[model samples]
Target: MQYLPLFVKLTDKAVLIVGGGSVALRKAGTLLSAGARLTVVAPDFATEFLQWQQQGKAELIQGYFQPALLDGKLLVIAATDNDLVNAQVYDAASARNMLVNTVDDQPKCGFIFPSIIDRSPIVIAISSFGTAPVLARRLREKLEALLPQHLGPLAELVGRFRDNVKAKITGFAARRQFWETVFNSDVVRDVQANRLPQAEQKLTALLAEPQSLAGEVYIVGTGPGDPELLTLKALQLMQQADVVVYDYLVSPEIMELVRRDAERLCVGKKAGAHSVAQQDTNQLLIDLALSGKKVCRLKGGDPFIFGRGGEEIQALLPHNIAFQVVPGVTAAAGCAAYAGIPLTHRDYAQSVQFVTGHCRPDGSEPDWHSMSRTNQTLVIYMGLMKAAHIQQQLISAGRSSAVPVAIIENGTRREQRIITGTLSQLADLVTQHDVSSPALLVIGEVVSLQQDLHWFGQRAQAAVFAQPLTHIA
Candidate 1:
């Protein structure tokens, strides 16, 4: 709070810079863009400054420091390389009660340039008071990625409708509410999709007929177990949700990211333990949406990939409830990558297959013969319970019992564990290590690369099962 933040109108206002190097050139660019009348004083100037002079965008005075140069200027910058000269400019400006900034010198600066996020009409300025300039810049970068590019155009559209909305809407609360609805409605989507005409029409219709509180369902994939792996759209929907229906597969770290005030409903499912049935969960989503709540059905891994997201959305379809599906990095891909096991390698593996251990009554069982092929990787999700059967079937189907295998537990998480061995001891390894749910089984020549490529977290000692090959089941 050393300096109060303000957005000043510098259009056509006089400004002075006391340098001719790259730093000065950078400051000049910002000032010129703001329509400031720039006058730079330095004995020698860069070539770009001379170009600006020829274009009449800047006045370059070829002389040393003089107090007379500060006259009639709205703002001053001491950007010179010489400390004594910059101090002279600062003293002169301060003595005349004018604002001054001495570049890279915090104490001497009366005003400082903040890291800017320019969404044009919607500009955001972040400053660390010059103490942590790099940190402030890094924060700006993160904000830039999070802030959508459509914001500037969206702001412009809202401004155009401001007067009309004010005239039509009765009270302050009502007007604010209407604006909120407009922002959340298809107008923003239309703007993002570059359908400006449709967006305008939507806004007009919204004003013509007062908007009702509608509901939406966001079927979001939390991405394996790593919270950072969530898609931007998934994170957005999670925060906006009034209700989050999550399962046990979602990690605690990821669950911490949900909106603080959002209501949490656990319809979690684990092997042999179903907290809420599939049909009941579908009915629950329908009831919640029918009551006009923004529901985020949080799932682990890609919702469409064995997450039963299709069933839930299909149920919503008949009821005409609006919904969106956001895909995430499924366990097969995420687990393999973090464990440093490439699913496909021309020298080792040429193809990959993803399968789930648990299947519904109507679901087809995995084709063990095709899965037992050489020079390919097979990733099994929720297969810990049937590891014995898997090992026996694959071995009986002519696959080598000595083939390298990896059981990745809690993949991509901080406590992620990987146990490697040959296919002969798949069940024994699981029992010995007590591998829990949410683990992935990777069986292939690529798994041999784990000892060479495992990069994240700690890994257990590689056990190449000394016991002779025997089908447990």
Candidate 2:
């Protein structure tokens, strides 16, 4: 380690700042948050510093920098714009054997502010020894996303029980195991689910009778292709999993977020084909959890909506396995938004329906009467193979043949393709462009808005009636 990292308790400690500009103000805010008693000496000061002085949060010394100002101070921060003044403050602090930080001047800093992830009582500080501060900040952001919001509260709850646990459980090794069991119990799960009172009650009960290690299943949705759209809860669970059972629809980018050493099993299902049968997938999840593994069943889009999540969860019910459902942005909403075509608009559509064009294994057709309703947008998932049948049925059921349509391929991703045409050209558009599975068919007047509202990916290639389908760059 280039720098030995330590978090010092600054509550009620005397600290001196040698500037009063915006830079000083920023440092002052962090110090005040840590309950530091601050004295700032500067010729001019920001309004916030003056307010802090009046509020008794800090003391103001209106003068130029001097070595005497560092007297009796535990820490000193030189935040002035002038390099010479900062060096002078650093020298004075060094002479007195006090810690000093010259803002933005790393070489003169005896101490440095690290990027902090404050799930307080569980704070994480990351420093790059001033070599790569921006990279350090980005890493902090990534950690922030992965850590659950309830971690702070969870830590506080555990801290409250520390004395009781120590008194009840004997020995260091035994206590460590006890705490590990507590973390894996329903107590932590309840806390993560935002049920604090329930979590507390469960924790108390678990203290009386610690249970054996059990497995859990997390049915997580890895929103349409973009890893950034994943929920924090999903990310947390993904990192905690012992194994991940994912689908082809779950983007490769999302799979990368899973725990590094986690066992991966791809039970990927696609349109008109099953890489692994639904029954086999459900049985696999049950078997994995029965083995006491933390299994993550990762899917693309909302699992309940056409992702067969209901079937899988129902199968778990008989086995009495514990599971959680973390919904992702269903492809319809995610795709439409990226294409800049509102699923519903006052002038175009009053409501929207998400329909799947993939027929059941028995080859039974969907209810065309309801799907043919006008003035509402229809977002069809897995409709590429049946585009002609879908278009003919809707048109026969009194829907407009000329309604605008947009075929969104790989929505929300960099290589997304948007092909615009009329309903009459829906199947022709798919065939001509060779649109594949995983594409969404958006049919309604709202599709026309892509002309004016299209924003994501390359410029959409519009298909005129007789011309070859324009190549989507």
Candidate 3:
């Protein structure tokens, strides 16, 4: 914090630009955007400066800049080509204790222009204290990409409702919470989507409320491996999450999408190790929601599958807590898609089944006969340890040894790997490939289509069939 940041109200304020070159023109443009009453003092004026002067948009004094020229201006800028003249201008402004900027000269200036991302009411200013302009500009570019263009409109909406919100909610905490809810609600989202009438309707409903609404929990599925696979509702829930309890399997990229200010609690449970028990996690959500905090129980895959979402939901049900579930691209689907193996195909497979490899300690396998039928795909989750047993059981149940099997490791991740082989040799292939945990095993005739359908693996290769690539931004 080399300099205290501030947004000066320059409207109707007198500002002087003591040069008529490109540098001076840039400063004049910035001041005009700020609604400053600008005066350009120079011996000679540029063509654009003369045009502005003729239009009376700005006043131009066709004379050399002197110390006396700095008399009563609210702000001044010395952007002249002459270094000596800029030094004199700096001295004159310093004597009068006025705010002045000497272009490119930090030591002689009262203020420096920041590399700003202008969203008007939602302006973001980045500065390197005149140390690195290029770095500051690069940082501004990154911020520009992260911030939505409709933020300006969103800010204007807030400005319009501020007074009403203050008058409607009496308690400080309640008032603060009201605004938080408004920001996280569908009102702002609808506005961003260019649905103004819908946004206004939502605002009206909020205004009609007699009291602040109660907070609730959202069970969000952060899709396996890829952040982009998240649902729009899931993204919104994450943005509004006051506290997020995440599992170890949630990728860092997905977690980064969460609000930076939100509290993140690691309650991940490994195969045999538990950091926070299931009961404790359920209790945490209940406590947070009761305290009026938006809680998000972020899981790796779809909550209803192998995830313990049912138990958590049951716990909340007893406590009368309100919660919503946001579905994600489950690991089975993600691995299958990224590996170029469809779970179902008309000629080879007609149905798809998802099953966990681990059964209860009673040592009974889950209906192996039904699972080994032809024209069906079997996706085994957390089944790396029992690959040999699973393969033998399926064979014993009359399934062909020639059935295609594909193991996808870290599917959808940058380091994702896929190994394809026959069902009889899948255990040996898995051993040779050293497939790790967090992998999915897909067994069906669909695996044979990998050679032609493996689009994800060939992203770097040029296509023989020409098609225009769409730029996301």
Candidate 4:
């Protein structure tokens, strides 16, 4: 590590800044916010600095660089453009054993200001040791969006009750567990909703009871291949989980958002491939929660859709395990939007239906007659294996062989591929493109709209409809 990160309190502390330009003004604003008693030394001053001096926020000294200026200062910043003057300030501060920072000059800096995300009582400081400041700032921007805005107020509220909690809760473990419950409960919800009085009341009520550990399951739907599609509640529960039970369909980018230290157990299922049996996955969730572990049953797309989430949650019912279901952007919706093929357009199609091509254990087939209805969009999930069967069945059920169709592979992701053709050529299109699982099959007149409305994926493949079925292998 090039530098030891620290957060120092500068409230009412003496600090010196040796410049009057925009960069110096920027540093001055931050110091003032920290309540630092500042003295600035420069031959000339900016308008803002003169105004700040008049307001008694800082003391302005009109003079050249001097070693004596470092006297009795806690920290110093040399924001001057002149290299010689910046070096002079650094030497003077170094001789006096004071912390000094030379803006934009790493080797000369005894301390470097970091890109900070301030949530008042909560603050995050990020630095790259001046090697990649821009990268560090960009990272800070991303974090700023991810972190909730009410964190500071929440922290302050908890801080006020620290003494009371410490007095009531004997062991450190007990207090930590208590706080975790508070964070996971309606207390946090109330706080986030800005209902402070209700939040405080709930916190007090919670503290009045004995601290105990109870585990629950969060059935989160990590939307179709896009991490950004995850709901706020889903992300919150994911981070709070002690263990995450995921599947093959869930995107890796979505998995990365789960709690870093949380144990991950994959029960990934695909066509003809099961990493772990569905029954065993149910038992695993029950076992973990029974042992007082918070389990997150994460699934790709909407759990209630074609994801078979109902069967998993039903198993938990007998055990009386608590669970939450967070819905996600299902594959049909995600893929259609990304591909710019409206599932239900007023002119193209009035109705839309979602179905899975995987045959049932009982061998009963979906009503092909209804699914083959005209002017209706039909979206098939996991249809790659049965593409030929679907094409044959739809045509046999009075659906037109010339009906437009599209196979969207890895929909909504950067590697997404869209293959468009007629229903007669659905099987051929899949074979030619070597389409894989987790692909959505759109069959209807709406698929024809891809020619004019296709927005994402490789546009070079946009001319897919022009290719004749016989042209493909």
Candidate 5:
């Protein structure tokens, strides 16, 4: 190591900063957060520095730098833009045997700041010693997503019980084992779910005796076709799950992320296909959870939005099963964004309506009269099958046949296809392009923006019908 990594205590200590611009402001903020009393000497300061001074966090001395300014200072930072002035500060501090840092000058820096992931009380610092700052920042970003937000609170909670745990558990090995069990148990789940009281009670019970195995179900949404769009909690649960129950709507790429050894069950709920019935699927989840297996019920898009997740959860109610819901980017939002079709724009649409093309068992229809209003974007999921009926009904309800529409096939996936036309040509466009399942129907004036704002896919592939769609009387 070129330089030793040390986290020093700066509480109420004096630090001299020889610059008052943006660079000085940045270093001052970090120092103040560490409880350092700052003395900043510079020709001029940023607006924020004045605010900090008013807040009694810093002492600003406006003037050119002199060696006397470093008097009685424990640490020094040269943050001025002028190279000569920065070198002067560094030389003065080095002569006085003080720890000093010259911004952007690695050789002159006695110390350097690292990229910080502040899960407070659980701080992770990544440093390249100024050689690879960008790479270090990227790594920090990755860790930020992986680390749960409840870690700080969990650490504090566990810290408070350490004395009690040491007292009860006889040996070091036993205590270690007990802690391992606590972490692997639903205590982490309870903490993550913000059920602190339940977690505390469970912890107390565990310290008293060994805990019996208990299982939990996580209804995780994998998002529309893009595995990258999966929530952090969803990914964590899928990796930790003992068994994964998934639907055909889940993309193959997403299924690849599940724990490799996990038992997989595909309860097909595709359009017009019933490989496994809904009731059987619900019973399967209930049975798997009862057998003490952490079950991840993975659904594509949001499970609650037209995914029949509500019904499945209602089934688990009588059984008194523990479950968590992780929402994903829905198809309507993801598809419309990737296709460059904004769901709502002030000039085109002021509101958006999401409806299912799949009809209910009771043979009911959506309120087309309300949905047919102008200046509103209509996004239909699984509407490919009933495109003809949708067109006729919407047109009869007063939606113009010439209203713009786009069929997003395999939306957000690599093989994604976008086909555009008018409302009258919706059924024809589907037939002509052979649009399949996993496709979304985007209708309204926003569909016109697809040509100009279309970003994720090739615009050439999206054939906009040149002729106006003929109205059906």
Candidate 6:
């Protein structure tokens, strides 16, 4: 490591800035904001520096930086324009064993300033160890958007209650677990929303029941691909998960959002491969929960639909394990939204139905007569293999040949592709477009509206064509 990163408390401490130009002025401003007693020594001062000196806001000595200026100072900045003068100041501070930073000279500095995001009590500093300042700043900008502005105040509130929480929870493990719950509770959410009174009340209520053991499991739905689409409750469950059992379809991006130290077990079932059988997976969940672990059964989409959540819950019920479910944007909903196809509309359709394309192990086709009615939208999940049979059955069941259909492949992903055609032509369209598995097939008049409602596809296409290979590389 080029430097050990640390944030020091400089309130009321002595700090010396050995320049009066913009660089030195910026450093002085940061130190002042931290409540440091700052003294600036230079041959000349900027207009702003002079005004600060006149207003008695800062102490300024109008002279060249000398070794004696390092006396009794906790921190020093060698920010002079002249390289030789800055080097001299760095050497002087080193001799005095004081922390020093020389502007634009990492090799000669005892400390380096990081690109910081100041949320006060919740400050985040990004550093590249003087290798790439611009990259660090860019990363900071990205983080600024992800983190809420009120996080600092929320952190302060948590800090104020730390003592009380510690006193209430005696056991070391129990205390750590209680704080984990608080971190994911509604209290933190309210604090982030700037509702201090509600947050405090919730915390007080939690403290009142310090010894209660109300363990529960949450079947959280992590939406298709994008992690941002995860519901608030799903995010909270992930943060509080003692052990997370996830599936293969759950994207790596969504898995990345889980607590860093939480145990993650892959129980994903590939078509031809199985890491863990369904029965064993169910047993593992029961064992973990019985051991008092707060387990999160994380699935790709709405767990109730095709995810075998019922079987898992059945196992838990026999053990009397408390559990709750958090619904997610199902594949049909996510694909329909991203493909710009409304599942239900006044003009296009009135009712919508979701059916699996895969038939039962008996190898019998689904009854087509019930599904062939008009004014209804049909979303077939995992239907790519049976598209031809489905079309033949629908046509035999009295559905019109001109009924529009759309196949959305890898919906919501960067590689998402949409193919539009009539039911009769869907089998052919899938062949022409080379659409793959994990696709959604939408059949009805609603598919016709997709031509005008298509927005996400156009953007995805534009992104693909606008960038050259070298740009992405």
Per-model TM-score, in order, reads: 0.61, 0.61, 0.69, 0.75, 0.58, 0.71
**Global lDDT of each candidate:** 0.88, 0.86, 0.83, 0.88, 0.86, 0.82
Q: Using alpha carbons, what is the TM-score of model 3?
A: 0.69
Off by over 4 Å in 2: 1-132, 135-208, 456-473
Q: What CA root-mean-square deviation does each model show from the true structure?
A: 9.2, 9.4, 7.7, 6.4, 12.1, 6.3
Q: Quick one: ranking by TM-score, best first?
A: 4, 6, 3, 1, 2, 5
Candidate 5 ranges with C-alpha deviation above 4 Å: 1-181, 184-208, 456-473
Candidate 6's error at 343, in angstroms?
1.7
On residues 420-449, what C-alpha lDDT tens digit does candidate 1 reach at each position? 899998999999988898889999999887
Where in model 1 is the C-alpha error above 4 Å? 1-137, 141-181, 184-205, 359-365, 455-473
Q: Using TM-score, give the best candidate's number.
A: 4
TM-score head-to-head 5 vs 6, winner: 6
Q: Which residue segments of model 4 deviate by more than 4 Å?
A: 1-18, 32-78, 83-119, 124-154, 163-177, 180-205, 455-473
Query: Can you give the lDDT of residue 2 in candidate 4?
Result: 94
Instruction: Output the better candidate (2/6) by TM-score.
Output: 6
Residue-level lDDT of model 4, residues 174-215, one tens digit each, is 576688878989988888999999999999999999766677
lDDT of 5: 0.86
- Give the local distance difference test score of model 2: 0.86
lDDT string for model 6 (1-473, tens) is 77888988988888899999999988888888888888999998889888888877789999998888888899999999999998898888888788899988888878888888988798888998877888998999999999888788877887888898778877654666777778779998898787999998998887787365445677888876656679999998898877899988787888889988889999967534568999999999988888777889998778898778888999899889999898888988887877778899998799998898877879877878878889999889878877898999999998888999988876665566777889999788877777766678999999888878665545544454442111000
Candidate 2 pairs with clashing backbones: none
Q: Name the lDDT value of residue 253 in candidate 1.
A: 86
